[model samples]
Target chain A: MPDRSHTRPPRAADLGAFAPIALAALVLALVPLWAGDSRSMMTVVTTGLTFASYAVAFNLIFGATGQLFLCVGALAGIGGFGSVIISDRLGLPFLVTMPMAALLSGLFGAALSWVAVRRSLDTIFTGIVTLAFALSFQSFVLGRPELTGGENGLQVAGGADTLLRQPVEPYYVFLGLLVVFLVVYRVIQRSHVGWAFRALRDDDAAASLAGIDVARYRILAGWIGSMMLGLTGALFAHYRGFVGDTTYAFGSVDVRVLVMLAFGGIGTLLGPVLGAAVFTVMDELLVDQAQVRELIYGVITVILFLSFRQGAVPALTNAVRRLVGADQPPPREASSADTGIG
Target chain B: MVAVLIDGLVLGLQFGMLGVGLTLVYGLGGVVNLAHGQMAVVAAMVAARLMDRGTATALAVAAGILSVVALGVVIDRTLMQPVYRERSEHRVLLGLLLMLGVGFIIDGVLEWRYPIEALSLRITGGPVEVFGVAIRRGSIVASAVIGVVGLALILFFRYTTFGRATRSVIEDEEGARLCGINPGAVRTVIFGLSGGLAGIVAMTQAMTSPVVSTAGVGLTIFALIVAVVGGLGSTSGAFLAGIILGLVNTLSAFYIGTFVSSIILLLAAASTILLRPEGLLRRA
Candidate 1:
């Protein structure tokens, strides 16, 4: 079995990757000032930020853990419902509803992880299971029309007004959440738990033999990832001022989530954000040509996958590292603790 | 109650036919051929076109099945063959993308040819009163055909040398290769056969209900759900699960409304995974 315990400090190569993300964020932040259109700029920034957060959360399981979960959209949809229900039905404050929504989603993720871990299934089976979960949740929400607003969807009265009332407010709120999630993610990535996650992701049996408690780490990743997704979903619902069954529909937004994660570079902290930005911009530009957009999207995805298997971010980082006269950091050393276990 | 049960059986049989085709491709090739549903749609549309041209029902069905088999060969040779050698997780993902692309292309061609509304032909036949429940003769015919075909498939798999070769390849490709079995040839034949089966099922379904371009996407999703619930690689499991899902869907639609029925089906599939991750039937 391969070593599963070697840990490395954040290298100079890591800083090069972080530089691009920081620059992009700075540019996005200064966009309103340059464009002199506060409203549209705010919308773009907030939308991009929220989607980035969702993508990042999605990547935790998909990119980092190498688990192909198809329910990110539904999880976010659930989070949206959670926030909307708390705020609209129970009349809780947005601040209160947000954390509660995230918590519920995290718990939901944990439960899913528990099932996934216990089953000892392969990735494809896990994917199918999650896809089923997404469909089920969508159905449950739509069936209980009183809760999810069914097909017509539930409108949060004055919901958009509450946030859009102040353009800067929405932007700042999104920025704050994005920052918090990113910080938490970065810190987690540097921790032992994060290393455990990587180990399990690379090889579960080997990780288990290395005393990584594979299931526990997987569950933790799911919990954290889902919490972030839930939070983003709540913000999106509030921003859009509605929550509907269609919002969580699989094969629609679900495909988009996968596209975003892949486009941005799965597994990297900054990949999702970049992917989301590019996707949003492309979507906006292509919205006029509605008939051919899907075809184009499919073509691009296939080409990208065929050409750059590591995804765009990792591929680009590798190229940049090569250009900058930097030694490609040695592959992270796997812990050599377990030998002859079989 | 009797009506619901009969309806459930009819729908279940239909699902069983589709599920069987799906299991063949998945079990033999490890390729989730998302294109399975599209093949069914193509068959249905071809049959519809033949019927429009005043062809006999039997001839139309035969042509439809033949066309589907031809398309399956095309697919296997072009899109699927390139990726067959490397059976990685990424290949499965790529298969999904390829199917999605192919589905879109099919949809585009279909939209150009057929109108948006669903097209159907009512078989002029009297209803049969069974146990005090009046049911369409068409439903009875569909059930009988499905049962016969399903039984034939079971027999073929159990008794035929081709079936043994197919099973050997499915169990262990390398071992099969060592035993001098050509995996590629086996896969191509199975894919073509499965596509033919899908075509027949699609034609029968369109005859029973209506044919529409968008119906292809819905059928694909339904087939996928059915296949997953039945277990990806288990034929008997798919058959049983299809019947179960068909009953659940029909009864739920009757009692809970159409939209809710779909939701219920989705939820049931999800719950099944939660309960039995390997599926109800574990194929050896």
Candidate 2:
């Protein structure tokens, strides 16, 4: 019932947050300049951008609202499969199918949030339930081989004639998506919705006492975040011209996204992008030694969770602050957003 | 129908054992061992490797379980230190993520070294009749072992002084500490016991179906679902939930298809959270 809108000028911290997104966009905009001709390089970067987008979406749901939707891969899979079926089977336009798929995913996410809220489940319980959803989604995909193409996956023919088929064009498309997602994240961070998110994340019972509609805001975050995941997933599927269960499996996608978000900074605007870029490069470097790469990734994940819980960006900023003799306790905005039960 | 029920009960007993391991850790340390299944796989792999080297089956299995117990203690002493320092939600999240990493590491290493290795414990016997239906002798033996272990756990927790100390810590760590109970030691012991339980379940599972290197994640998922449905920290609840889920699983697999059974099991777990977030039987 409160007027959760703010028409006042943005604060200095809020404006400062946009700087990283702009810099990221500018730097990424020029990626196509050098890697334009090399198809493999473009493909890799484009794939990295896709994950970057997924990480950003995850950040919105988790870092903002403390809803640990472990089914990142599942929601994206929904979008990927939905768009593929609608566009390929029904012969609909990519534009129509993409939004429909995204909306469907958003609704599913909202429903998950509704269930979580209605039950008053904690973070881990929410994670468990979503994880169950993720496992079932994988089974469903594999169980219905006739429609989903089973383990072999389906060849996406819907966008074969479009710019999506072009290597460089698809790279830009994913990059564009990543930039837009970052902007959306920044916008949310500066809004009254952001205020409500912070309150509930800090103390849910207190936030509800202060007249914030905890359930509504959590669902809103889940819906919007899932829509982003769905949109990016569908776009990635069409661009790659394939969709499969493994494409969004728990081990393949969810693990990497969680690792990336942790390495980058949970709540920071640039964290997901930074984390994605680093891991993308690491992924490429160890592409040949898959097992070894996974082992290394596992070690890195453990180390990050233990020592670098605040993530690389925050750590770097803190170090820089200390160097500049501005050793005021790290800014509250950059502190850990871990919604722990006090 | 009777054969399926017996098979379901067999599998359910193992599921109950797995849930007990997970629930104990969650109750005592507020840690969710996402690597629970990996521990089982590692133990199975150890046993398989030993058997290949001509070790006695019983000795190999013992060594395997001990190895896992040591692994659990090491993890509790080292990695879980920071995790335990965290309180409530943070502790759960950190523990889950770190254990997930551990699972990945185990999976990566085992797959790299033993891609073709699988543990299949062959019991020399004929089919046994139960309730007018023939059931595999191996299944009956596995179920018997699990039943004994489950009973031992119940009695251990019910009557033992150390078990009472453990319950005290889980109920109120501060109060237990004030009463001179070392919560840290209790947690480490439970973690090791949980690891041992996981190893035992893996061996029993191999009596029914091969426990391969890649079975880690799936095993973990089953354990998680059982623990969640039964209630996070209740031993008896785990067994009850496991039996129920096991029956549901076998029925769905029989009526529908094997592929859809997993989906059905997951749905059951999700609905449990929706309908009964506190789980079937609260804490121990």
Candidate 3:
């Protein structure tokens, strides 16, 4: 890989672009406070934030990198199971087991990316492989009664109260982690590596010719994405106070994760978080009519995809640009120079 | 031991029937059609309904197949055709969402109409004793049918002009279009054929076991694994993979246990993607 580090100074404006992020954070923090009985509201907020992390991890590849991985839930499942096995079965502490689970999940993600990155497999093939992985993961978990506790699932020792010691604690923990991940995401998006990722997304051969290590970037994206998923899985397991193989099974919470990601918009940084929040509210409102909930969600997602192909975030950004009466920025010219490893 | 092998082979044939249909669609259309398994459920339910209305077994099967073909055509024309035209990255995602919605609609309608009560149908003959092993007559008929259909499909794809056109489009769309082939027409035919095959598989499997809405998703996932493990775009690959998977499933269930058997199969499928990403059978 060519070293392009000395070509230009790092983009300083991007680092200072945090006004919107701060506003968003403040809004989230005040949600429970305004809702009153802040406990339940905090619980809901924590859950949404945790899921948003998974979506963000997914967006690393799906959005910025342009690799669609349908097995996000399966990776999360791996993390959840790993944490449960280590913390509950092997008697390891939650903190220790959580990182271990995240590491293993990243390894699995890398393994998956290795199969997918080079082949130029179409979207359908990617879906097939990822879906198969998800199914296999579920089957393996459910089939192994000894290891996974079968359909009954493994029960962790502590509930949310035990870990957080109070509802507000979990809320703060999730919010802090969410902010940190967002920062990491934005930083990566503005970095040379991030540009390489975007380049590969647009055209792999061109990116490769430009000296970007496409395969390595894809693998790295998967690894990073899986690590985020693992973190969320661990947090979920701890919060729920139990882990079940069926938790990530098809048509269960896994589908909900996909819906949230899609609803918020693929490839956008803030879409997943917004999507999660929207879905949670919708789920709460439609709790009674659960049967038709997925149908409605699916329909809405289809409509959104049709109307806003680039996703809600981009669409909103474009609208803001138009409203401000600013000329649309010209597309960036492709750099002919070689860069460091993607 | 002989009985287990015989039973596994028969079950494997039934799975192959379903797997081949899925393989064909994926090969030609590049759509996974997550609703494929649910199509089987729809077929089985239709057959059961026909039987309840005092229809003959043959007639029930025919009705099931016909209904599935109609449903397939409708799906291809409306939901799938638009996605094909757009040719967007979201096609697969949208297809998945649409199918999930369809699955829900079908499940809801079926549950409301027929309920989940089990219906056991005996296809008239007693178990045949062959080489001191007893095999159900229904299993024998199902296996023979599957074998015949599989052979016919191979022959059609190999020799027929329509088959050549389909293969041409699958191999190189631009090249085929230059040669005056309509990819859309080929897609429609393939989808219809797949639906009919799914119907047959569903009918046979349901006859052997029982049909219910809850079983739809499980069977779809099972068929998907079989298709992927065998090879995504190869019919022969799917057939062979299904048999291999069936044997592994049976042997594992018998020796290790059902749970371990499932795990082993899952691990085997996953490891294949990691090791041989192209799958067991490579389509030339």
Model 2 misplaced stretches (Cα beyond 4 Å): A1-16, A309-342
Instruction: Supply DockQ values for each candidate.
Output: 0.39, 0.58, 0.30
lDDT of 2 by residue, A146-202 (tens): 988889999998888899998788888888889889889878877789889878887
Pick by lDDT: 2 or 3, better one: 2
lDDT of 3 by residue, B104-207 (tens): 66665655555664434576778989898888887787788788988998899899999889888878877999999988888888888899998888777765
Give lDDT per model, in order: 0.72, 0.85, 0.71
Candidate 3 on A134-248: residue-level lDDT in tens?
Answer: 7778778887778988889887763433645476667767777777777777678677888887788767789999999998998888898888888778778887777787666
**Model 3: how far is B123 from its true place, Å?**
1.5
Which pairs of residues collide in candidate 1? A3-A334, A3-A335, A4-A335, A5-A335, A6-A335
Q: Which ten residues in a row have the lowest lDDT in candidate 1 chain A?
A: A332-341
Worst 10 residues of 3 chain A by lDDT: A330-339
Q: What is candidate 2's lDDT per residue for B229-282, written digit by digit as tens?
A: 998888898998888898889989998998799888889888987888888886
| Per-residue lDDT of A15 in model 1 | 52
TM-score of each: 0.87, 0.93, 0.86
Which portions of model 1 show Cα errors greater than 4 Å? A1-9, A12-20, A30-48, A158-172, A308-342, B49-60, B107-117, B256-264
